[model samples]
Target: MFMRAGLTIGEFSQITHLSVKMLRRYHEVGLLEPDRVDESTGYRYYSTAQVPNAQVIHRFRELDMPVREIKAILATPEPEARSALISEHLRRLERQLDTTRAAVTSLRRLLGPASPPLQVELRTSAAQSTAAVQAMVDQEEILRWYDGAMTELDAALADACLSQSGPPGGLYDNALFTHERGSATVYVPVTATAPAIGRVRPFVVPAAELAVTVHHGPHDDIDVTYGALGTYVAEHALAVAGPVRETYLVGPPDTADESAWRTEIGWPVFRTGIRVSG
Candidate 1:
C-alpha cells in the first residue's frame, strides 16, 4: 500500500500542509522519516500513507507543544500517555491564547488618538496619605529598584504604590532622563483609619495649585507629552517650582496593555489664569 501511493517531499508537503524545512527537521529529530532516499542525489520520498501522521505532528507543534515533549510522546509507544500529553498542551495553549486576546483588545483601545491636550485646570489638591520608598536611582537602575519596592509594598501592605487610597504619585528629586541622576520616592496612599506599617505613614507632598495635563497612554513616550504641556505652560507664563508628579488613573495590570494607561501630569506652578505678555 505504501509503495503504491509513494510521494515526493514536495507532494507530501502539499498534502500534509507542513513546510519542507519542517519535514527535514522531523526527519532529523526522528519524529518522522522518509520512506525512501535517492542513492545519487540524496533526495527524500515519503509515502502518502504517512501524510496523516505528518498533519497530526504539524497541528501539535502549532499548538506550541515542546519538541522534546513531542519526541517523548512519539517514543512512549503508548495510547494513553500520548493522549494525556496532548490534553495538557491544549490546556496550556488555551490560557496563553486568552492572554494574547486580552492584549490585542487593550492595544485597540490605545491605538486611538490621545485624549485632547490637557485643558488647564486650577484647583488646590489637598495633601495625601502617603507610602513612599526613597532610593538613589540612576536611570538604568530606576526600573529595577521600582519593581523591588513595589513588590515589597505588595507583600507588606493592602494599598500599593500605584493603587488609589488618596492620590498615587512619585516625586523625582533630579532628572533621570537628562542624566542628572539622584534620589526619588514612589508614593501611594494608605488606609487613613489603619495604622502605619513600619515607616510607611502619613507623608505629605504639599497641597498646591498645579498646572495639570491628562495623558492617556503608556509612559514610554511621556517625555514628548511633557514637553508639549511645558510649552503650553511656558507660553502662558507659568513658573514650575517643585517636582513634577504623575497621578496614575489607569495602569498596565489594571488594563491589558501598557498603552491603555491614563496618567495626570501635574507641574506645581506659581502663575495662574490666561495671562497676556505685554
Candidate 2:
C-alpha cells in the first residue's frame, strides 16, 4: 500500500505541471517537503496524495501571486481564507488592468495620422465665476498630492454651497511637467470664487475668448481632446499662447461617476490665417 501511494519526484512533477527544480525549491522553502529521501543514494520521493496540493500551488503562482502569499494560503484550513486571499489579489489585478487599458487607449489616439494643425487663433475667455482652490504644490509631488488636494477642494466647495462646472484643472508650471516640483493651482471656476482657505486661496478665473470644446471622458484621454482642440485652432488659423484651462462641469462633487464627467478645454490662440490643421 505504501509503495502504491508513492510516486517519484519526476512523476509528481509531470502530473502537477511543475518542474523538478521547482519541487526541490518548494521543499527547501518548507512549502512541500518530500514524503521520503533515500538514505544511501539521496533520491527524493513524493506521495501521489500530494498531487492536488501541488497543482493548486502551481495555479496560484501562475496568476502572479507572491510565494509568501501562496504559502499563507496553503497553510489555511478554511476555504474562506483561501478565497479571501484570491479576492484581494484579484482586486489588485483589476486596478492594474484599468490603468493599462487607459494607457493603451491614450496612445492609440495620439493621432499622427492626418496630422495636427499648424497654429491656433486667439480668443477671449470671459471673466468666469468659479469656486477655486490655489496651492503652491511641489512639482515632483503634484500627482502624488492631487487626490488629497482634490478632496480638500471638494470639502471647501461643499461648505460654500457651490457646484463645479467641470472636472478640476491644474495650472502646472513648465517645471512640474518636466523637472523638479513646482507650484500649481487645482481649480474649479464657479459663478463666484468661494471664500478663501488659509494660503489655499481663491480667485475668479477672468474669462477670455476661449477656443472651447467638450471633452467627454477621463483625463486619460485628455491628449485626444487636446488634439481635437489643436486641430480646431489650426483649422481656424489660431496660435495658443496661454495656460491650458479645464473647467469641470460634472464630476466627483456632483457624483463620483466617470461617464457623467464633462470638461471644457480652452487654449488661447492667435492666427496668421496661413494655418494647417494637422
Best by TM-score: 2
User: Best candidate per lDDT, number?
Assistant: 1
Error of 1 at 76 (Å): 37
Model 1 poorest ten-residue lDDT run? 193-202
Tell me the spans in candidate 1 whose CA falls farther than 4 Å from its real position.
Answer: 1-118, 159-164, 177-179, 193-202, 275-278
Per-candidate RMSD, Å: 8.5, 6.1
lDDT of 1 by residue, 1-278 (tens): 35343688888999998889989998898888899888898889998678777877888788788888888777777899888887888867775765566567555645767756456665577777666666778865665677676555554466433344754567765476567587777776765432355545446667877777777676555666677677776877775657777787777547878767888888777755564222
Estimate every model's Cα lDDT from 0 to 1. 0.71, 0.70
Model 2 CA deviation exceeding 4 Å by range:
1-7, 25-42, 46-56, 66-92, 107-121, 126-152, 163-167, 173-176, 179-185, 190-220, 227-243, 250-262, 267-278
Cα shift from native, residue 49, model 1 (Å) = 42
- Where is model 2 poorest over a 10-residue stretch in terms of lDDT? 114-123
lDDT of 2 by residue, 190-252 (tens): 555576764345665665556666676676676677777766776666645555666667666
